[model samples]
Target chain A: MSTLIDILLLSLMGITALAAVRMKSLFGAVMLTGIFSLLSALWFLILDAVDVSFTEAAVGAGISTVLMLGTLSLTKSEEKTSNHSQIIPLFVVFVTGGVLIYGTLDMPDFADPLAPIHTHVAPHYIEKSGAEIGVPNIVTSVLASYRGFDTLGEVTVIFTAGVGVLLLLGIGRRREDGDE
Target chain B: MTHHFILRVITKLLIPLILLFALYVQFHGDFGPGGGFQAGVIIAAALVLYALVFGLNTASAVIKEWVLLVLIPLGVLIYAGVGVASLLLGGNYLDYNVLAHDPVHGQHLGILLVELGVGMTVAAVLTTIFFAFAGRGHRDANGNLLPHSALSDEIRNRKDGQP
Candidate 1:
């Protein structure tokens, strides 16, 4: 029964991905992409990466959908049909997907206790984090401390994105005449 | 089109609770599934709801654009400042242990400060994006930027028999 459910979910994810790319209406595509993100989040949860799943659900399904819709509001709703099938993009996607799938074949099975990831840095963090940081959530400790530099970089990236949007929109610009 | 008794009463009751819940989430993130980002979005959503029901102009009065502009950078500075503080205390960057003489207390303080910063930035940025989209004077085929708004307005206009 569980296997059946897994297969169903996987198929649903595939269909959602296809729909997200192939939909003619831009709004429909964006919404379907959100569904794709949601499905991927569920997949992550099933794989026991609860923290990753939460981040995916929030940033992917929530923020990405909102950002896409905002962009859609500023542009056309319907994708223009071209004579060509966009061979370059198709080739790029195919190559990337093939490489990703090939790479996954060498990875340990999902949720494997003996996985290298579980044996290596993770176990050290899991065992020592409590004594070192006194934090129950090791993920938080790792994010804010052991990997503090990376977190700083991530925050900087977010700030940069915010600045990029502000520059592009000119939402808070002052007029040359200083008029409201 | 005018004020309704039920909505006015409900909104008045709900706004405070939403804000309180946001603060709770911001502080409780250390122990739970929520943190600054979620709290910020929830608060922004509540404000957006108020704006939607009242008017953009009215909401802007409560949360001025200038205030939001300041908040964006303020949150980032607050977050980075904590790290700087930690560095100044003779630890690596963002080493919260140096935030106070007692490492545990310092961690707690650091977490709270960063969470507050994250919440403020998230809320401000989300609302800013919402306002940018909603404030744009554009109309689709149904004469609304959003389908949900169009449907609600259609229902309201039909009740009022507006041209």
Candidate 2:
């Protein structure tokens, strides 16, 4: 039953992706991308990665949609057709996709017990986090305590991204002032 | 939006609920699926929604630009401060085990404080970005160029049923 739902959701995601790519209106494409993010979030939920699902829903669906809409207001709603040929781009995409698929061939089967990730420090986290951290959520314990430095780095990265956006958009400068 | 009675009423009712939910997700993250990142986005979304309908000036009145600017770095400092505190207490950087007499209690305290810092930084940063995007090329109530105006012509066009 779950597999069927996964298949359905995956197909829907593919359809949404194609629609977003083919859509002429940037607004519609943006909305389709939001739908795509929502479907991906659902897929994450199905995989029992609830934390990932929450981030996907909030960042991808919520924040990105609003930001894209803001961008659209500053630019044209309809994408302008370019005289440039698509053949080279299409060829490049196919090559990249093929290489990515080839790379994945060496990856372990999904959820394999012998996978490196499962064998790695995960066992210790699974067995010891509860007693050591006194937290029911192992994911939080691993993120905040076991790998706290990494979490700090991630937060710093987010802060940097925000600062970068503000810089590019001219946070303190008014548009009317024409100050670069 | 100011002219829309129904929207104004609905927004007034919904903003508090959204903010409350964000806080719930932030503090309850230890036992649940959400964390600082999710809570921050949700809280930023609530503020953005309010700004969208109530105008940027109103939102700014609620949360000033200086406050956001200060908060962005303050959160990171809080997170780093905890690590420094642990280090001074004879633990490695970010090692929460030595934060208190009992390692478990220290871990809990450290996690809670760190998450709060993350939440504060994320919320402030996102809100600042949204303000930067939405406030460009708009005027304030005083007819001055509002540094963080929430006016978007596309939004107005959509609201008016135009393409």
Candidate 3:
């Protein structure tokens, strides 16, 4: 059942990607990308990574869609036709994709108990997180407690991104202008 | 926008619920499929929807840019403050075991506080970015989009010209 769902979702995702790539309108491409994010989010849920899926849906599907639309509004909505050849880029992409797929062949089966991830700290986190952190969600325990520093860095990155955008593009002076 | 009456009405109704859900996700992260990051984005999304419906000016009035600027760093401060606090208590940096007599209880408290900090920062940062992007080139009273100024034309040309 899960495999069937996975196949369906993957097929839909491929279709969305192709459609997005072929799309001429930035608006259409952005919308397709949002659809792609939502589909991947659902796939993550099926894999039981609810936290990752939720973050993907919110950030990728929701916030990014808005941001991309804002970007589109600022620029031309249609792609400018380029006479440049795409052969080299396409060949490079194909080669990279082949290499990645070849590399993944050595990975252990899905949810393999003997996998390095399962044998190492994951079990310890699962076993001791309840008593140590007392959080019902083990992901939360690991994120906010065991891996708290990483999260701090992530927050700092977000802060830095906001500051960068503000520096590059100052906030709108529209409100004050209206009052005058 | 004014003509999109149904959209305006539906957005007005959904904004409160979206905000309430964000709060739920924020506090319930420890027990649910969400956390500070998701909740923060959700909250910003609510504001974004409002801006789309009522106009950017109305949304900016609702949340002053200065307020967002303060909020951005304040969240990181809260998160790091907790770490510093734990350090002051002599349990290493971010070692919440020293927060209370019961180590588990202390961890919970620490997690809640850090998550709050993360939520605040994420929400503020995202909203600020949106304001920056949307407000940089704004609309006139007729609701037509306008570039910031003659200077913005040069900026946009450079931006779009780049690969």
Candidate 4:
């Protein structure tokens, strides 16, 4: 049953990807991407990465769809037709994809208990976190307790991104330009 | 879609629920399958939806741009402040074990504070990005700039693009 679901979701994702690529209208393409993200989130759920699935659903499917729509509104609806050849970009993408897959070949299987990553600190986290942190969700304990420094860095990166956007555009017209 | 009555009504009904859900995701994250990052995006998405149905002006009125700017850094401060607090408590940087008489309770307290920080920063930043993008004036034919509130029908109805 799980295998069937995986096949169905993966096929749908492939269809969505193809639709987005073949779509001439940028609006349609953006919507297709949103659908793609939703499918990805569902796939993540099936993989037992519930926390990851939640983040993907909210951030990838929900927020990114809105952001992409905002971006699409700023530009032309129809994708501009270009005489430039697509072969070079296509070749580059293919090469990159091939290299990524090749790199993954050396990695452990999905959720392999004996994998180096699992053999490492994960065992400690799974074992000791309950007694040490006392949090029902180990992911939370791991993220906020065991690796608080990394989360601090992530927050700083988010802070920097917001500041950069402020410098570039600023939050709208500051409510004083008399323009709604 | 200012005149979109159904959308307007639906948005009015949905915004509170969305916001409540965001908060739930934020506070309930420690026990559930969510956290600051997910919750933050959910909160921003609620405001974005409001802006979409009602208008950016109304949405910004609810959450002023300056407030977001202040929160952007304030969240980082809150997160780092916890670390500093832990440090002052005679633990290493971000070390929660020494935060209280009991290490587990300290972990709980530290995790909540830091997650709050993360949620705040993520929510503010995403909303600011939405405001920046949607706040820009749309360009029309003949190289004339049309204010966002008055985007030309041609662009507004372009295969039902975002309004």
> Which ranges of candidate 3 are over 4 A from the true structure?
A172-180, B139-163
* Candidate 1 lDDT, A1-180, residue by residue in tens: 877877888999999989888889999999999898898889878876665776677667776677778778777899988898789988999999999999999999866789887787988898997777776767666766677667656666666666666665545453132113
Per-candidate local distance difference test: 0.74, 0.87, 0.87, 0.83
lDDT for residue B69 in candidate 1, whole number 0-100: 77
Question: What TM-score does model 1 achieve against the real structure?
Answer: 0.78
DockQ of the candidate models in sequence? 0.19, 0.49, 0.46, 0.44
lDDT of 3 by residue, B1-163 (tens): 5699999999989999999999999999999877888899999999988987887778887998789989999999999999999999999898999998889889989999999999999999999898878876454433334543744775576578767
List pairs with backbone clashes in candidate 4. Answer: none
**Which regions of candidate 1 deviate over 4 angstroms?**
A1-3, A51-55, A85-92, A174-180, B2-21, B48-55, B136-163
TM-score of chain A of each: 0.84, 0.91, 0.91, 0.87
lDDT of 2 by residue, B90-112 (tens): 99999998998999989999999
Q: Which residue ranges in model 4 land beyond 4 Å of their true spot?
A: A99-105, A172-180, B138-163
The CAPRI class of candidate 1 is incorrect
lDDT winner, 1 or 2: 2
TM-scores for all candidates? Answer: 0.78, 0.90, 0.89, 0.86
lDDT of 4 by residue, B27-104 (tens): 998898778888898898888888787676677778877788788888899999998998898989998888778998
The superposed Cα distance between candidate 1 and the true structure at residue A17, in angstroms, equals 1.8
Instruction: Encode model 1's per-residue lDDT on B1-92: one tens digit a residue.
Output: 56676786788799899889877767776666556666777787678768767766677778887788788778888889988998889987
Q: Report the lDDT of model 2 for residue B102.
A: 97
Tens-digit lDDT string for candidate 2 (A1-180): 977888999999999999999999999999999999999999999998998898888888988899899989988899988899999999999999999999999999976889998998889999998899998888888888898999999999988998898677655544333224
